[model samples]
Target: MTGRHILVVDDEPDIRSLVQEILQDEGYSVATAEGGEAARKARRVRRPDLILLDIWMEDVDGITLLREWSENGGLPCPVVMISGHGTVETAVEATRLGAYDFIEKPISLAKLLLTVERAFESERLQRENVDLREHAQPIIEPQGKSPVMAQLREQAQKLAQHNSWVLISGEAGAGKGTFSRYIHDQSTRREGPFVEIAVGSMSAENSAAELFGAEDGETVNYGRLEQANGGTLCIGDIADMDLQTQARLLSVFQTHSFTRLGGSEDVEVDLRVIATTQRNLEDEVAAGRFRDDLFYHLNVVPLHIPPLRDHADDVHELLDYYIDNMVTHERLSYRHFTVAAQNRLRNYGWPGNIRELKNLVQRLLILGSGEEIEVAEVEQAISTQSVSGEPTAQIVPYDLPLREAREKFEHDYLLHQLMEVGGSVGKLAKRVGMERTHLYRKLRALGIDHKKGIE
Candidate 1:
């Protein structure tokens, strides 16, 4: 699906028609504007992947248009200037205003095609190499007030004072990447580039060249290490790195320098590294899957991320946070979770951790309707691909943590009272000597349905 839309803005009807027709033939979705005002209107309607703007337009020149856009919200996409009588001074000014490239008119069709292709490719690569935090809202406070999480944040802040490398470990989707960014953002070098590379996604043949730049004759490709110079480089899924790459990385850690894959000169960098793993690195080292040297080096300041279930109390806050996130970023309609629905979710095992919870919120927003999400809706949602493939709430184990054990006893005590009173919550509450509202909340927290097995 080459859904790439290009906006062509020029006053001349003939040139616009010719360019539009040619670009359309090349499988691009092309939109044309007669002049500056039309270009503005077209851009308001939809953001373009690339804009071909003429230097001399009837209403406004391309330079003024670029200036306006830069001031407003920065250029929405790359803009390439086209001028038949373009002077070097004009080209320099256009470049200064953030024009991707200059295309002199008597436009070389071959050059035009190549520039368009290269612009898209460059943009794609830039997005991939930049910070990997998608849907990046302010991290706000750590939503978890659980002591374990608070101490973890404190430890992160302490370790951030130094430029020492860090290794973050957790289950998949347990927010290892989140803590890495928190550490980076808190560190002294926050203003510098914070580049990230997904090591697991790279191939064995390309991994070394990707981590360390490769030079081919006159052409040189700067890799993640060079890109992250003077700042933090988060090597995501570091345990997935191949042995050869691990050795090369160890060399870089030993000496803050590496030669480009095909070049002779050594490039030195002032770098801080943050590596994340969802697996036990020591086990990997013993299995000969990962290098012992690399393991020790990364474990210098290791931070362990607790699973979502450990601090289950935070689930309510996380639910609110994600709901806001979905509404603000994903444009999903807001839906309130009923007290009973929230309680059911908090007690869930959350095998997939925070990532799973976020997905669940997104799913409820998309698939479920109405203003409030009740407990039945939650049960229906979780029932599909549930842990046991059954519609059941998790049973609290006999040897549960003290907090959970107390909750379990309260739930059973109230449930038995409710049943004895013939499934009437009002009668059960009066018999239990508790306020109606507070007892209702307690019943919900325990996932006890007073209406169950009643005529």
Candidate 2:
């Protein structure tokens, strides 16, 4: 509230003047309006951070104006109702009408300032939702129209509507997590929790504990299975689960029930399991490294997400999506990619997939030191850091939008960063000023590997 501007709307000049003097002395910028019409005018003119609206007015009452604003949704600022005759019932009615808070007449200056501060804080939190939406909107796009992709999405949607177990197989960076989320979003239990466990990242014993609550008289923390009781659970790289853990998991799946590691009580749940693997589970089964029964159970609704190379037609669409996102997130004056750059993007073997492309777009938006991403920039970013000593792909013009071309440049640039940093997400996130969770989400969305780079 230090620098916030406050609007005091009152028919009485004396009350408005008192509020203005008090708030101004407390370091808030205060503006006064004589009546409802004047208040509305001031709101539009000043765009005050908070409003104190008097209930009784000549032309219109505060409650009426509040109702109008609530119904039409124009004024962005929060409104606090004020009235000398305001009763608890009137205040409750005002609140039900969408007034942020009600301050009765003969208000204490201390209480007034405190309420105003809270109103400003609430408004700020509401604005953050817009930011989250901007970040989440891209990954929320339906799987595109490629025949293979459409089939994948169709299967996911159909399976999501049921409570069947699903298994997703793909090469690294093939958007397994994205598909998993899509299934969860489409499922009958969409409102239920969708817990994900990274079997490869966590220790086998600890991972078991995480998946099936703790043992031994210890208060059982809810495991992924318990958390996803009515919904879905995604197991990333399930092929990496140890034999013992796999055996226990298989039991849970078989009985549709599990007990805490140390507890004997059986907890039955209705869980829809979704497992993902970069490695071929069939090969793992042949090698005896994975449980064949477990694999079979998870494979009930088997889905193979095709790699980026298989969906070359979607390259431009993906590029545009990433670029649009990058330009907005980085607050950059977006520039188009040169013709040569577009050619290079379309031809490049995107081993990292969509996640890789997303990171690249973000990198170029924030790091590319050029008006437009040129072929030379792509070459310098990719070829100079050749992990396999291979020359960069020759530019191939499959005809893409300037924005799409820029996205290609970005993907190349992102790969370059991963190469430079040896694929450390923490370091990458730090460099980009984003949380590791957010960076990981973007990488997963773009189909980029957090482990391997261009190599």
Candidate 3:
């Protein structure tokens, strides 16, 4: 009911209109199709959460269209078969073809509503199960008993109860997505869709169309923002959003609306935005790469997820959790970690944080033998990872443009030298053979804080 789209397909205009009106009145966004072809075209335009298809269509019977859809890709969503003269054989065939349920044409309004609700609930459970089987986190919240983690979980929960936009900052792979999901689940909008858009992964040219959608002539494409209406829109790596798209997004925030590509009508939006970033957006804003207004708007409720190293005490718990998850979900042979192995891991530096720890556990489960994982295996894994990491860290990334590569090298070189000189600008200038004024300018240009990173 929370902005879920439903498509009603019936040859009779009255039936189609009647069904659409009822569903819309029930708080669903409804679309109507008069025949099988119209239904197919409607589905192609936008995916409906549930499909109400009449079996006794004029052009192609509902069963044939359903089977065509089933064979082509799959039944796109949960479908309920509608018919007045449906036999037991017809009902059996529809069910075998992936229909959620069957309803007679003189539909009982109450029964139809109940069936639709049940279908949605069933679909949600199916998705959660699929996610669990895929070895994802499986709805478990932040798993740590450390003081910082305890406080973080509590703070996030409290913040999630509000209506303000959230800005979550953290290191890469530090469970930013997990925290975003946590907030949405804790929020009043939990029943709504939680659409995630990874801005960093999107290309510049398609960013706008992908996010704001597109409209041309009679066709309309619903974008992520529209899909997430009456819900939460979680944007990952918001700092990497294209500048043009940034302007559009800022305009949306200011007006609570946006126009799709090639369309003049403004689409009013009613949803919370939860943005996540791994970079210092303040620095990005200062450098004029990000819009300051957007930053301030999203930063209303800032939550920084602590890197795993700060809570190393939770390593033991994390290790056990992953072990059980792998065993339960993936059916991997479980191996218990010896006390020595656990202790070694607790003291080890997790450069990649929770992500690294999870991968390490997965590797040990698949590759190591014996019921108990010994410290030797753990040490070997750590050593191998370190050796690999060191070389990768030392390699100058050739993929970057020459200017970027040079700037990165210069930044690292100057930062190391500054740290080496005990954060003393005078000593750093002397060591790097640069004038004090120019050295200070260089540090500022590279976004390096000359005052920090020293004992």
Best by TM-score: 3
State each candidate's clash count.
0, 11, 0
Model 2: per-residue lDDT, tens digit, 134-219?
A: 33443664446788788777777788778778899988767888888888888777655567788987986598888886544212
Candidate 1 Cα errors over 4 Å, as ranges = 1-141, 385-455
lDDT of 3 at 153: 91
- What are the per-residue Cα lDDT tens digits for candidate 3 across 1-455? 35788999999888888888888898899989999888866755555778999999889899998787776546657999999999999999888889999889788889999999999999878866664433344545888899988898998899889978999999876778888888888989888777888997789998998899877654556688877877889999999987789999988888888888987777777888999999999999999999998999988889999888888999999999989987876567889999999999999878778877776777677667899999999987676453212212245798999999988888877865664443568778877889999998889998888876222
User: lDDT winner among the candidates?
Assistant: 3
For model 2 the local lDDT of residue 228 reads: 63
Q: List the residue pairs that clash in candidate 1.
A: none
Give one digit per residue, the lDDT tens place, for model 1 in 206-304. 999898877664345667887676578999999899998999898889998887788777776677999999889999999999999888888989999
Best-first order by TM-score: 3, 1, 2
> In candidate 2, residue 22 scores what lDDT?
92
lDDT-superior candidate, 2 or 3: 3
Evaluate residue 405 in candidate 1 and report its C-alpha lDDT on the 0 to 100 scale: 82
In order of appearance, the predictions have TM-scores of 0.59, 0.57, 0.72
